[model samples]
Target chain A: MFGEYSLSELASIFAMQGFSGLILFSVFVLMALGLAIIYGQMGVINMAHGEFMILGAYVTYLVSRAFGELPHALFNVYFPVAMVAAFLVAGALGAFVEWALIRRLYRRPLDTLLATWGLSLILQQLYRTIFGAREVGVTMPEWMMGSLKLSDTIEVPINGILVMGIAVAISIAVGVMMHRSSWGRQVRAVVQNRTMAGAVGIDTERTDRLTFAVGCGIAGVAGSAFTMIGSTGPSSGQLYIVDTFLVVVFGGAASLLGTIASAFTISQAQSILEFFLSGSMAKVLTLLTVVGILMLRPQGLFALKLRK
Target chain B: MLKIANLRSGYGASEVLHGLDLELAPGEIVAVMGRNGMGKSTLMKTLMGIIPAMGGEMSVAQTPLNGLKSHKRVAAGVAYVPQGRMIFSALTVQENIETGLTVTGRREAPQDLYSMFPVLWEMRGRRGGNLSGGQQQQLAIARALASDPKTLLLDEPTEGIQPSIIKDMARTLKQLRDARGLSILVSEQVLSFALDVADRIVVIDNGRFVHEAQRADVDAAAVERFLSV
Candidate 1:
């Protein structure tokens, strides 16, 4: 079934495979972006990041179900609704976590990590209780379920392409928000020097809460988009959390560009390896590579300057 | 104008500022000179509402500042340029300056931070972490100026800075006070700098105000004795 015919056929196969790689990169990049903001900037390990993403996925699932009875034409309009719902659900949860738990743990980063991990477990169980333990496949709209054939030898699924495009757009939007805007500058200021930022009247407290919320909201968007291609369940986020963290840590914290670059490298490597090796072994290989590189460069691919 | 009466503050268990009474007139360069850990910076922080004051009356204009949050005090037209020139290291010079814009609310930054410190203008794209100490000091002071604050609180502005930059900063403070009628409350460890610029001097020793004098009344021997031990 895997065998191909000729040179043109092989080229098409590579193109199709490259498209799949891009899709993988997009998924991981979005997942890592939130983790990057939380862990990189605030130094909060936020092990609950995956759960936040799962909350978004669950929100997407609920929206899709609610809209299922609507006319076919109306289903298309509900996409925006689903996105907004996912963002609000995840962001609200994030704000709550910051207020109830994170605010108290600012002085103890490690404790925050442990506490967030516990929160992640609690959230997962909460999800399982509400959504049931079964793995649920997201039903794509008719337009999303089809594939486009570039040639006789190659076909690329439309849903994967859509995911790839959305991921790139989100990354660009996030970068602009972090680099170009006044609020973005304030966020960076808080990250760089919290006390100094306060001294200058930057409202560091507000910045902290908003930054965490934005991070979780983006994670929700990632999770919602993931429903297009993957299984959704309480534990669905756990499957990606390790990979997400690997991408962020291997990329470097607070470095969005680093996240994108590392996502490309890691996803492509894993995709190529899975083609030759077993799927589980491919992941192990990628993880090992990340570990080795991190050992050599303790600061990862980018080093945020801490002092002059 | 800035005013304080019966200001009392301290860290947990130990009091650092005891019933501190002081005031800064609009457009006046007043200095609080002391040795290390003499509650100079603490007084500055208390005025800015960073560290909670145990008890006191503090005000910027008619707005009471003792109960206000640090950021609110900033918005009330009080600016603080802290010691060690704490500019955001990872931010580019322009981005660091932009932080001042956030605190200023709807008000736009005046013409050019670049004009105030031409070197910062020349290296606007460079990371603040890469700038020299003198440049960072300039950036810190320039950042405060960006808000067009009515009162500027500078804590040890000359610490770890080059002599040329020190003179430039002193000159800039005078010029700003003269031009904008900016109220200045500067904390300093060096007597010479304070003597050169201050209209009045207040001395704090071991967390208590020990002496108050106008420039001519400031006895050098008394200052040295208060600062020594």
Candidate 2:
């Protein structure tokens, strides 16, 4: 594949592919970060994770339409406002789902998977009924419409930069929140030993609820970012859900740094391979490599070491 | 002060602690001693609200803890150090101690806990999993103390500790009582350790207290016989 291209052309291909891979990395990190917390810490298999992301996308779309009618000066600010609204709306729904559906299934991991799968179906159909069956694209604020030309062959979309920025910011925020915040302490404690965490006065139930909500809230933010690259369809989250889980599992589910590393590796590998091979072939090769690595190191890249 | 009345708790359908009543005066150390499956741990768990009361009442500093969840019971002033010292393996010693402080919504860990368990202070930055068994036990006690709890419940404090450390643990329990004016309820299997630390001793057999006596009046031969089977 490289034989036909000149050295400069190859350089441009690598740079451009790497940049696109970064945008893909942002989406994977945002989605997988939440799944890492939820599936990793709580052991709750949230099959409806994609639906939660889609909810955020639809919410962002609606917010954009609403902001479109506002004064011309306010239009530029709609994206940030929509992002916040997406977080709260999705978080509120997540909180409700946790209390009503998930709290009962804490001990039943398999049941959570089945129940949440049902929840995803319901959420998808609801989105279809409400937002219509067709996919909707949010109108980009004018500032996000342009591309930065690094070279004649290497052009990067402004929105891609914005998406990557959001990913980095949220990742840092999550890292700090999980390490420094009191709730993070509680969450970690609860994950290690729920009964002991309770004895120490950390409300395990409340911790579980908040952890799940925060996970969903992150997916919502990812949804806000998702609008820039993909249209908001009822089933759009389905396209990314498998990749998100792959990132989480391949990274070592409980390790934040591992998740980031895996997301980057997978995204970069897929994009670069896609440039050389068919898109499906790229996905297959990427997955095969991950599976091969997992077979060798089943615990993942940076699994937490605990004595049995 | 800590009080448990007609306490009955069990796993699922099988009752473990059957109508057991106990009380601890402020600054008192009481040991509930029994062999395995005699409900000593059950009594301790029931007191800590880790096990739901089948039928009974528990209170710490006069706050009724019957319907309260385990965490709420801690906030109401009862703390627990379970068997094997259930430390948050991933958390630093300081963070583990701070877990108790969260009950009172206090962000800072108590400085005195470091003094009480000086080893924990020395290894405050180390993860809980790195501590020695004795160090982890002391850390567990220190963690429970961070909330400034009125009462502490310990289940099998000597479970995995060496004989030398067991003596030190007893001494520390006495020190904790003298310093904090906190009542302690410790469940144990070893009579010598109980005799060494407890002001009062009660033997549980078949989910009920079969023998009760002040530490001075405890019959070593009789208690040993009950434990033999």
Candidate 3:
């Protein structure tokens, strides 16, 4: 591999690969943040989380198609409107799921895993029946198109920069919400001790429902962003589910900073390695490394020191 | 004020509190004394709606609370400090107290809560997990008081606490009762602590209130007989 390329060529390749890795990092962070909230804070193994993401993608697809027929000026602002719609639709469904299914399985983590896995399949089939089996793509606004030239040999995509900005904004928003908001205090309380949270007048059940909804809403926004890089299909969300879960677990549950850090590490490793090796091999090696590290530490990169 | 009539509750199929009746007047502290596994904590849990009341009626300040959920019961002016403190260990002391304010829709805790447990104020930025057991207990109490509840239910507040701190806790409970007109229902294994703070004592055995009397009129020997293994 070293002999195949000259020094200048290698530098440009590495630079381009690094920038691509950042784009991948943005998607991983967006997906993992939602999973972290559900699995880490609420302790609910939501296997249907990917399906929730797909729902958002489908919503975005619908919004974009609807805007295509309207005035040309409407197309520019449709992305934000689609994002909000995706969040609301996905969040409403999440709240319903919590009320109907997740609430009954609070004490049974494994049961929730199985039930949500079944729910994921059901949702996939529902999408297939409604949206068809074909993958759909959204038209990018004019501002989101084109690339910026960095050097004589290296250039960066505007869409990639946009996604990175979204990821950073969302991560900071989540951190502030978790630390500074009153609702976040109630969520932390319930996560630590449900019975005591209830005793102290915190509506533990409501807190749980809202947390789950917000987590799903974030996943919706992630899916909306995904349209810029990948096409939406009934099973597109499934492709990213395992990697996102790995990001969250390898980061350390309940640690927002850890999630972003882990996403960056994993995405960059995979992106760079894929340039030299096959995609599957790169993924396997990255995952194996994470597993090896997790086995030694078991608490991931940053564990919250909470009393049993 | 709090009132319970023939309250029955338990874990799973096994009943722990069998038609137990109790009452508390405004500003009065009632101590439920019993040995382990004798339904002392169960009574407190049931009162707070932690465990469903299998059968019976409960009211706080004339508001019926029989069918209310735990949070709704808390909103009905009842607050509980469960056994082992059960503070949100990962949260900072200030955030832990803010849970109370959040539930009650209040912007901040009362200034008196900080004066009552000054240690909490000193370590406000520290995580609850980092606190000593006594400090955690104080945090638990302060968290409960932040809700400004009409009634407080405390389970084994003095357990594992230092003697000096226990005295201070007793004094704080007395002061809260006298100053705020808050009714308190506390369950304890320590006889002296209960006697030190309670206006009335109820002795429980085998999930029933077998003996009840005013603190001044109670026979110490008879109460000890119910508590002794």
Among the numbered candidates, top DockQ falls to 2
Residues A1-27 of candidate 3 have per-residue lDDT tens digits of 768999998999899999999999998
**lDDT score at residue A53, model 1, on the 0-100 scale:** 87
How many clashes in each candidate?
A: 0, 0, 0
What number of backbone clashes does candidate 3 have, counting pairs of residues 3 or more apart or in separate chains?
A: 0
lDDT scores for all predictions?
0.85, 0.91, 0.91
Candidate 3: RMSD to truth: 1.5
Q: Which candidate number has the best TM-score?
A: 2
Residue pairs of candidate 3 with colliding backbone atoms: none
- Estimate TM-scores for all models: 0.94, 0.98, 0.97
Tens-digit lDDT track of model 2 for A1-308: 89999999999999999999999999999999989999988999899999999998999999999989999889899999989998998899999999999999999999999999999999999999998999999999899988999999999999999999999999999999999999988999999999999999988989999999999999999999999989988888889999999999999978999999999999999999999999999999999999999999998898867555
Clashing pairs in 1: none
DockQ, computed on Cα atoms, for candidate 1? 0.70
DockQ of 3: 0.73
Candidate 1 local lDDT, B1-229, one digit each (tens): 8999999999997899989888888888899989999899999889988899899899988778978887888888888889887888889887777788776564445655678788988888999989999899888888887776889999998988878778877888888888889999999988888888888998888888889899999898888787775
Candidate 2 off by > 4 Å: none
Off by over 4 Å in 3: A306-308
Off by over 4 Å in 1: A1-17, A304-307
